[model samples]
Target chain A: MQKVIQFLILRINFIIFLFFEILALILYFSNNPYQGAAFFNSSNAISASMMDFSSNTRHYIELQDVNDKLAKENAKLRFLLSSKIVQNDISNRIKNDTSTIKKFNYIPAKVINNSTDKYKNFITINKGSADSIAVGMGVVCFDGIVGKVKSCSKNYATITSVLHQDMLISSKLKRIGAIGALRWDGNNAQMAKLFYIPRHLEVKKGDTIVSSEHNSVFPEGEMVGRVTSINIKGDENFYTINVRLSTDFNKLSYVYVIKNKFKIEQDSLESLNNLGKNESK
Target chain B: MKANDIVKTALSFMIFVIFHVLIVKYFVIGSVGLCFFYLGFLLTLSLSIPIPLLLLISFLVGFFVDLFYDTPGIHTFASVAIMFLRPKIITLLTPLGGYDEIDEITISSMGVRWFITYTLILLVFHTLIVFLMEASGFSYFHWTLSKVFCTTIFTTFMICSFQYLLFTPKS
Candidate 1:
């Protein structure tokens, strides 16, 4: 007993070091693509407040650019509203029962903190559970789809940016309607890779990619990016294509969090199908 | 350590944490190089600090920085591993006559060559661990290596400049 006690005391430093390393590793692995606990991330109260202060100060320098973009979008929207074709179509459309039902709600929020240099990037926004911003809701800006909300506190939420390594966006060619998955390769902030695009499909540079109906989070036909390059290997079955993301992650300011009213119903119906398959098996 | 020294250490700790989380976090150069100037605090800690205490301090500082960066355990693991290797590296690099009166690791206290060697060795290990863990695998091996190399150089330059500009040599 005495020898064992002496041995343990002699190596206390090593033991403590091991203990902390193990604890830290657990925290690392558990919080990998997304963190389950909100307190450990920037969305927590104190860090979020600090980010809010910094963002408030930095917000003014980019005001001119933000105003320009907003003006352009406003002009486009106004043009659509004033067009005779759109007005005539709207007036002649028959009233359908399903058309009256609201499917999605948008909540405007300001981004307080954002990064694009890391392998996994997250955006912190000012809206959270208090504002009806929940995990898995889609976020979009004026240009294109941004990302999905990953975690939320009472007053703040963290979004998993499209630039994140683990994020896979279900997208399709806007012209040809060929579906593929878009993912960031952890190298460039402005570019991502599209996979599962069959070689037989005709993909060309400048082809637009948009969110497909297959994605549960994002609304259909939301702009994702434009194809920049395509690589076809003799041995590979799928074409390796590169896309230039439409949303400028570096200068993100304002975004809208989308709440799909039918998501719960759709998810439950899908899960029921899976349950039936399992029972038959 | 004296009471005065303890107070100084605490003050510097807060300054390092705040500066790192706020300013240094956004100073990424070309998406390749990142400056982790906060590690300067760990690298210059008084050599007499026990290994256990050093480990604890590094873990806390790393965890705090991680919270702001939203990289939970990545920083903590890297800093802790480097701190554990710190004492051993110091013993291996001990001078011929030994570190007779030197209490802390600084360029003024130790000569430039010794300071560079000590910090370079530790920074390489620190950055290697950080980038590898952040990458999560060998898949991005080449990209990760480039990031590690660039970040170590950037961080070293920042740390050296800060030491020269801030700390005065003892008479």
Candidate 2:
């Protein structure tokens, strides 16, 4: 009886260890779906507050770089403003006969926490549902696109960065307008893979790539990256294009979250169209 | 454990967790190596602590770090695995006199060579598990391996040196 009791006790230890390990594995895998509200992620109030404090301490050193970026962005915006003034007269005449309306709003947010080292890289921002930030909203920086809002708590939100393994953005060649999809290969944080361009299309290293407006997430012609290299697979009809992402995620701080005013109407209309097609069938 | 030892352990635990989340977490080497200095908290625990208790301690520690790292269960999984394997490793590397005389785990208590070997084995195991899980699979096998190697060497050096420089065996 004594021997049996000791044996059972030993088995119990292994059982408990296994139980905890299995629980950890379940949490790890469930994070992949991008919908589960994870309790332990950095966007939680406590974690965000901790990171906010840390970043605040280092904010002075980072301030110079941030200022430089803001100045450059200011210059670019100034140039755009000057150019727009000249074109405004012509645009006004054209606009009087046209019905084009703005459909996107931008909410600026500060990055409280970010990591570029992991395969599933994420960024935590200071905006959340309280600021009208919602999951699936697009995030962009001054340079170009950054990521999409993944999850949000009361006052913080996490971004699924462009560097993540499963993050795919629809993009197009700037010069030729050939459409393709961009995805990270999980190797280099600076580079990503652009796929689905046909083999016959003229693509070259250094060709610029930009976001396609077909997707509701981003404005058309927003710079995504530039082609760094192109590989042709013999069996496939598409060329595997390598792109150098424009936004440096390592230095990312300030970003804008895109709110599509027409998203609800667009989604409802698309679903209605689908329903109508199904009923017609 | 005596009151003094318990107090010291609590003090060190707070220092480790605070240092990890506040300072070391930001120090990444080339987007590959991550500094998990809080692991020393678990590594330095008294060998006499029960296996179940140690596992629970590691889970909570890892979970706390995960909250700050935005990694959810990655660190927790790695920490628990290393804790579960800690006893087997200690037994395998037990010196000629055995673990009878050992109460606490530190470089001064275990000798330099023995401490290095022990720390290397466990740190490497922990780093491998963490990098692999972070990559989500063998998809980035070479990248993950390099990260494991980089982090193990960095963390082992840091932990062993910190232990050697500061830790003193308590009677």
Candidate 3:
């Protein structure tokens, strides 16, 4: 008993150090990728406020560029509204139709902090659960698709940007209608690779890639990126196509979170089908 | 003597942390490397302080920095590890006269060569742990290594300048 006590006393520092190191490792491993249990992320109160305060100072500096982008979006929205009104009149005459419900809502949020330099980058936005933001919601800017909300606190949310290594978006080429999954290779923030696309499909540089209907997070046809290059590894089943992301993550300031109204219904139906399959088996 | 040491250490600790988070954190070199002059806090901690106290202080400082940096517990892990290893490092690099007889740990108290060597060793060790944790894995092995090397050089230079220009050796 005395020997054990002496042994412990002799190596007490090492024991204490091991205890703290283990605790820290637990925190790191637990609060990653999923981030569901992460309370110390940037979206948390202290970090979010610090970033918010700094971003507020920077906001005034980029006012001119922000204004230009807003005006351009405003012009495009106005044109779309006018064209929609004409279509409504024509559709009303053609067939008196009703029953299609609104499927998506956009919640405006300002990005408080963002980084494009890391392998797994995240963007912290000023809106969180208080503003109806939730995990898994798609976030988009005026230009194109941004990313999905990974986690949320009371008044802030973290977005796992498309540049992140783990993020994969279902995408389709507009010109040739080829479908693939978009993933970042951890090299460049501006570029992503589209995988699982067959070489037989007619593809070209500058082909527009958009979010596919297959993805539950994003609405179909929302711009994802443009194909920059196609690399066909000898006799491989899939062509690796490089894409230039539409949304510039480094300069991102404002974004809109997509709230899909039909998500609940679609998810329930899918789960019910799974249940039925399980029962049959 | 104890009261005076306490006051001096506290003041320096606050300055190191503030300097790190507010100023140095913003200065990202080439968008990859960052200067961690705040590590001066750990490097300059008085040798008379106990191992347990040092561990606690390092954890607190690391936690505070993590709160600002949004890196969760990576800093805490690195800081605590370095604190735990500090005694062993000192023992290994002990001068013929020994560290037990030394008072303050400023560069002036310890000769410039010893100070430089000591600071560089601990700084590199801490930075390596931090970069590895931040990268999350060895997947970005090359990138993480470059980041570690760049930050080590940058931080070593900064710490040397800080010690030479700002730090006043206790008379």
DockQ of candidate 2 (2 decimals): 0.21
DockQ of each: 0.27, 0.21, 0.29
Instruction: Work out the TM-score per prediction.
Output: 0.54, 0.54, 0.55
lDDT of 3 at A195: 98
lDDT of each: 0.88, 0.85, 0.86
The digit string of per-residue lDDT tens for model 2 on A201-270 reads 9998999999997687787888899899999967889999999999999888799999988777777888
lDDT tens digits by residue: candidate 2, B1-171: 678878878987987778889998898888877788999898888877778888888888988998898877889999999999888998899778776576788777777898888888988889888877776657789999888888888888777777756766444
DockQ of 3: 0.29
Tens-place lDDT per residue, model 3, B1-171, is 499999988888877888889888887899667888788988888888888788888888888888888887899899999898888887788898776567677787887888888877887889889987777557688888888888888888888888877767656
Q: lDDT winner between 1 and 2, please give it.
A: 1
Task: Indicate the worst ten consecutive residues by lDDT in candidate 3 chain A.
Answer: A34-43
True contacts kept of each: 0.63, 0.46, 0.63
Winner of 2 and 3 under DockQ = 3
Chain B TM-score for the candidates in order: 0.94, 0.93, 0.92
* Runs of candidate 2 exceeding 4 Å displacement: A1-43, A96-101, A274-281, B1-171
Better of 1 and 3 by TM-score: 3
Best by TM-score: 3
Count of clashes, each model: 0, 0, 0
Residue-level lDDT tens digits of model 3 in A1-281 = 99999999998888888888887777776766544334345346676799899999999999999999999999999999999889888887665333233678899999989999999999999999999988999999988999999998888899999889999999999887878999999998789999999978878899999999886799989998998999997889999999999998889989999999777788789889999999999
